[model samples]
Target: MRLAIIGGLAAGPAAAAEAKRRAPDAEVVLFEQGPHISVGTCEIPYLLGGHLEPETTLQVLTPEAMERTRGVTVHVRHRVTALDPRRSRLTVEALDYGSTREEAFDRFILATGARARRLGVEGEDAAGVFTVRDLVDTHAIQRWLDTQPVRHVVIVGGGYIGLEMAEAMRSRGLRASILDPNGRVLGSTVACEASDLMDRAVAEAGVPVRAERATEILAEDDGRVRAVRTDRGELIGCQMVIVSVGVEPRTELAAAAGLRLGDMGGVAVDDQMHTSARSVWACGDVVQIPRAPDGRRVLWPLATMARRTARVAARNAAGSASTRSADRFRPFAGAVGVRAFGVEVGSVGLSLSRALDAGFDAVATDVRHVSRTRAFPEAAPIDVRLVSERGSGRILGGQLVGREGAALRANVLVPLVIGGGTVRDLAEDFDLIYNPPLGPAVDPLKVAASQAMRDAG
Candidate 1:
């Protein structure tokens, strides 16, 4: 059996390795358009900040190593232009060869992730504006930083990538300014409260944020970006600009092949990662997945979901009886954990506003406490807002903001909600580990849960 997988970053490589494990005799091959395969996209920010070195950014597993160790072939810089499902073949263009080739496969997996979004503005194609999605983009920006006297940077977007790049550019001694059309910093991803927290952090760090604004990149004499003009009648002076508005799944190949696309603008797949087409599967950021709290298909671009879905695709492709585990098929565990400015802020599940929108009577309780023991040294005030169903006391969602050990508690709320545990469950039966050097004797989660249950009654 011959199996072919496209886009050998996280999902493609995972499916290949799992297929190799399931069917040792099967011939499996994966293709990646980039120079390196199986690189961690989430570590890009740390790499830019010098927290992680670029030399160690790409996880280099040579094709020879994969072939010898796992019986898989990894072809780098091989771009699949088209897929013929009827013939079970892919039209691949190898950039190094300057030629196209057709490869046959008995089974195929489409994990061709997403591309960075671009602005349609007149001068957006100028030399200094770039996106920071892939390693190549990161390298390009880093190389430019090394050569240019970049004193100011204009980031057009307030999403995760844009905010991280702002911090990274600031660390590089550049005056970083963000221009977001949305009223809040994180916009749709985070609630207004969390957005305000980020705004405060950015302000304290001396980073400039122009909210409710759009940009028009203006070019200088050499067709290079000189400044960014906003729709709100303001011009931000900067030579370098980074735009990370958002991403759309690269599903053109799959859509052309008669596969289903989801409302979330990604490929549609079943719980087992099988697409509508026979013997074809999809995963990663390309697939629209079930959202938590409700079962709506949402495209959550976290790495964890991609890996789990890849295992399902690999199992089916290898003719194994294995199915996607229940844990993998569920909605996003609903956690966006972030820490900045000597403070931690996190949100999980649905916010009170979201729960109300979803036709649930949501009640929220705001609790404040010292992160450490009251008398302990370096204690910081912690604030938690616990949201629950008004009648049932079921823990629906939560938000945590404080200094020290606070962001992690938001992670704890996700599993509780995912497992269908209620506020009563947390209030009465939650077991917490405690250490004077780490956690308080009464865990903040339990404290919040108790308050939630009391309010529910």
Candidate 2:
């Protein structure tokens, strides 16, 4: 089998490695347009904060290591310009030398990933404005920091990237402010109470946040960002601006090849990660897969989801008989975590608003507990919230907020929600580990589950 994978950042490399492992004799080739492959994009914020070294972030998987150890052909600085699904061929270009060639493959995986969404405001082309997407963007920001006197930074979004960058700027002794179009921070993913907590945390870290949209980016005569004008006619001055509005799937290549797209604006793929075109599969941020809670197709764009879908796509491409079975490939339940302003937050499955929107009578309960026993002097407060179906008590989702152990606690609910466990089952049957230094005997998860059960009743 000739397996060709496009876009080697996260999923493409995984697909190539997995395909080679499954079928040793198969020819697996991976192509990445950028100079680097398998970058840890999630750690980019830490690079700005000086917590993580730049060299460490670029060491995910070198092309030479991928080829030598994994037995996969790794081609960096090579872009796949066109894909002809009917002919099972790809037109590639060598970026450095301006050379083009055609490669035929028996199977192909598209892991094209996503690009950062632009603000599209006036003066967006100004010099001091940047979008955090890849290593190049990171280098650009670092160069600006070194060359310019950037004392204050204005972030134009309230999502994870915006929040993380705010924290990073604070660590660098710069004034960081976030301007969000949404009324609340993390409003789309977290509940109002949790969002309120995060707002307070950011405020405590000396980062000013405003719930207003940026109307335009005003630039000086030198074409550098000077100030940002808001909808309320306020101009906030800043030396630099970071836009983290979100990301959109890079699926122009797939669309040009006549591949079907989902309602979420991603390449449509089935549970087995097979695209609409035969002999081709799509994974990573470029594809929309089923959300396990409601079985609705949604764009997760998470690293964990990317790797899982890539493995499934690779096994299928390798013609593994066991992988062809329906039961082996499970749908993805969205799980995500973020740390900002010394607070760790995590969420799994759906928020209460999302559950209600999915046509379920959902009720939620929030419980506050000490992470450790009261006798422990280092005990910190942990807040947990659980949402469940009103009548059936079926667990739907959960959120956790704390200085520590918040992400791990939220992760425990993922399996329960995926396995269709009820709130009562978690309250009565779940045996969570207990240690005085780590957590109390009565786990916070159980407390949230028990409260959710009562709220539902």
Candidate 3:
């Protein structure tokens, strides 16, 4: 049972490790184009903030470690240029030196991850402009900081990566500014109120956010990027720029292999993470699955998703008798914790507008209260909005904004969502722990539910 995994990052390595564990004698090989595998994308900003050492986060697993510990052949600096699913083979190009070869596998797992999206704007290729998506990007930008007189930085995009990078650069004593084309910061992921709160938090950190602004990078006379031109005709000079627009799935290999591609531009996979082609599977950012809220297929890229996908894909790849099931994989439960920036904002399930768009007669209730016991020292005001079906009172979605610890409180809604608990169920439910210092007399969940009950009437 020979298995070849195209990527050695998050999902690929997980699948390889799992497959080896499932079938101890199985021949498993993991190929990575870069020097490292299993690197943490979330910690890139922390590395920039000097919170972590470069080696601590960059190389997740060395080839020597993977080979010796996992008994798996790990190939670094190798590219799988082409795949021949019909022939059960793949063409590999060794990047270390001049070498081309073909690898045959009884089973194949395509875990190729997504890359950072580039705007392709003028001066984008300049030395000062960078994207913080991978370890190399982090190293490159950090190296530039050593050589360049980086006093000011302009961050393009207001998404998760953008916000994290903004904080990282600012904490390092660089004057950071974010230019977002959206009307509000993090508008694509968070709702209006949460976005505004985050914006305020960023402002408090001395980071200015330019909203609804498009940027055009202008090169200086010395062929270096000097300033970014905006739609408002403002040319802001900055010594460095970090562009973190978003990510797109790398599905060219999947598409060429005649596998179905989803509307979200990811490879289509079944519940088991198996592709349309037999003996082949796909996972990670390159595979789009169904979102629970709307039953629509979309790419919800996250480390959690990568890990789960790896387990499912590996089971099928190893031909395990106890195959994995879809129930093991749940729609992503994600939130953007704004508490790190001073305030707390948490969102889950879906939004009111999205619920309505999905054909639900939804009504939402907004409540304000303290996040902790009233007598607690640092009890901050908590503002929450919960959306429920107008008549049925089915819990659809929720958002929380408040002081620290508010994000963790919002996580209580996850089980309710997964269990299909409604406003009525929450109103009558009695299932939670309470400590005076950690919570109020009445849990915020019940308080919000009771408030929603009133609004439902």
Worst 10 residues of 3 by lDDT: 320-329
Q: Candidate 2 — which pairs collide?
A: none
The reply for model 2, stretches above 4 Å from the true place, is 190-195, 320-323, 326-328
Task: Please provide TM-scores, in order, for all candidate models, with all chains considered together.
Answer: 0.93, 0.96, 0.94
Computed on alpha carbons, the lDDT of every model, listed in order, comes to 0.79, 0.86, 0.79
Q: Candidate 2: worst 10 consecutive residues by lDDT?
A: 188-197
Off by over 4 Å in 3: 53-55, 192-195, 320-328, 335-339
Candidate 2 similarity to native, TM-score:
0.96
Candidate 3, residues 344-375, lDDT tens digits: the string is: 67787777887788888888888777767888
Best by lDDT: 2
- Candidate No. with top TM-score: 2
Backbone collisions counted per model: 0, 0, 0
lDDT for 39 (candidate 2): 83
- lDDT, candidate 2, equals 0.86
Could you give candidate 2's per-residue lDDT for residues 269-386 as a string of tens digits? 8878888898898888898888767888888877888888898888887775565655235766677888887788888888888998999898889888878887999887888888
